[model samples]
Every structure is written in C-alpha cells, then in structure tokens.
Target: MFNNWSELLPTIQKAFGALGKSNPKMVKAYMALGEAAAENEVLDAKTRELISIAVAITTRCDGCIAAHTDAAIKAGASREEVAATLATAISLNAGAAYIYSLRTLEAYDSLKG
Candidate 1:
C-alpha cells in the first residue's frame, strides 16, 4: 500500500488543523467551497464521495484519497463500486495523457506553421 491509511488521515487532519489556525480565512473558504459544492443535489453523498476519491487518485493527493475513501466507505459505497470508480480514475489519468499528447502535436504543427 502506498500509504498507511490508518494513521495518514489523523496526521493530515492535524496538519490541516494547524494550517487552519494559522490561516483561518483560507480554511474557512475552503470549507465553504466544499459545502457549496455539496449543495448541488444532482449527486448523492455516496456518489459525490466516489467522485472525490477518483479525483484524489488522479490528482495524486494522498490526503484526499485517505479522507474521501473513508467517507466513501462510510457512505455505503460497496467494494464493487469503489473498484469500478478506481478503474474510471485510471482511465481518466490515461485519457489526460492521451489528450495532452494530441495537444503537443498540435502545438508543434502550429509553431511550424
């Protein structure tokens, strides 16, 4: 496992709490943004958490993955659901590279032109 997920969350929580104490407004704004995003009713809590986990994996945010994975499991996400979402995350990461490669080609052609 890449992370000791058991202790990672608590350690991250402490680090974030320290940051929040040092910069209250920034932390508050971040929390508010999360709340605002959750206000949208299109996705249920479980789905939102699943999406969050996917984003965390693709973005390489271990803290986010640990937090959101715990949240997802608590939200009643099944093992199958998590597995499928992980696969989606992997595909998205690959797709991003594919798209960037296309953009690289385009940039070269445009520069040559």
Candidate 2:
C-alpha cells in the first residue's frame, strides 16, 4: 500500500505531485481546519480520525483513506477501531443507497400507475 511513492507509476506520481502544487491558499485553509478540529476538546484524535476515514471511504478518496488511516494509527487507534469505522461507513452508505433506490422506484411506480 503506497510502499514507494517515489517509485509509483509515473502518471500517479504526476497526479499527486500536481495536487500538491495546485493550491496553496486552499491547502492552508484545510490545514487551518484540521488544526481547529484537533483543538476541539469534545473530539479526541481517534474520533476525528475515525470520522475522517469514514468520510474518505464513503467519498472513495484513496489518498484521503491512506492519509487518514495513517493519522488514525498515529493517534493510537487500533486496527480493529479503523476496521469498525470502515464497516460503519459501508453500512450507512449502503442504507443511503438503498433508500435512494426505493425512492426512485416509488416515483417510477407512481408514474406507471
């Protein structure tokens, strides 16, 4: 898993490199958000990491998943905790998708009738 960023495929490396160079102000803003979030007494680091990983997984952002997973581990989250967060994300996402499907089918059913 991203064992060698430097040795990554050229296209991937370029893409990531471009992302790193793209937006200084936005990057700073995100950094500020992270800093403020960390300072929130009600949200411990592990909690933050769990939420971050859940969002990353739901949003299908591989880079984010990697970054947040590492952060979670560093913040003293066990593997089980990270796995549980992912499971919760998957479950909730599935429920949301199913609800949308049901809504769409209901709309079509009404139109058909």
Please tell me which predicted candidate would have the highest lDDT against the true structure: 1
For 58-99, candidate 1 gives per-residue lDDT tens digits of 999999999999999999999999999999999999999999
CA lDDT of each prediction against the hidden true structure: 0.95, 0.82
As for candidate 2, its clashing pairs are none
TM-score of each: 0.92, 0.75
Candidate 2 lDDT over 1-113, as tens digits, reads: 64552344454546756766897677678678989988857989889999999999889876677677777888999999988998999999999899999999999999999
The per-residue C-alpha lDDT of model 1 at residue 100 equals 99
Model 1 weakest 10-residue run by lDDT: 33-42
Model 1: colliding residue pairs: none
Candidate 1 deviant stretches above 4 angstroms: none
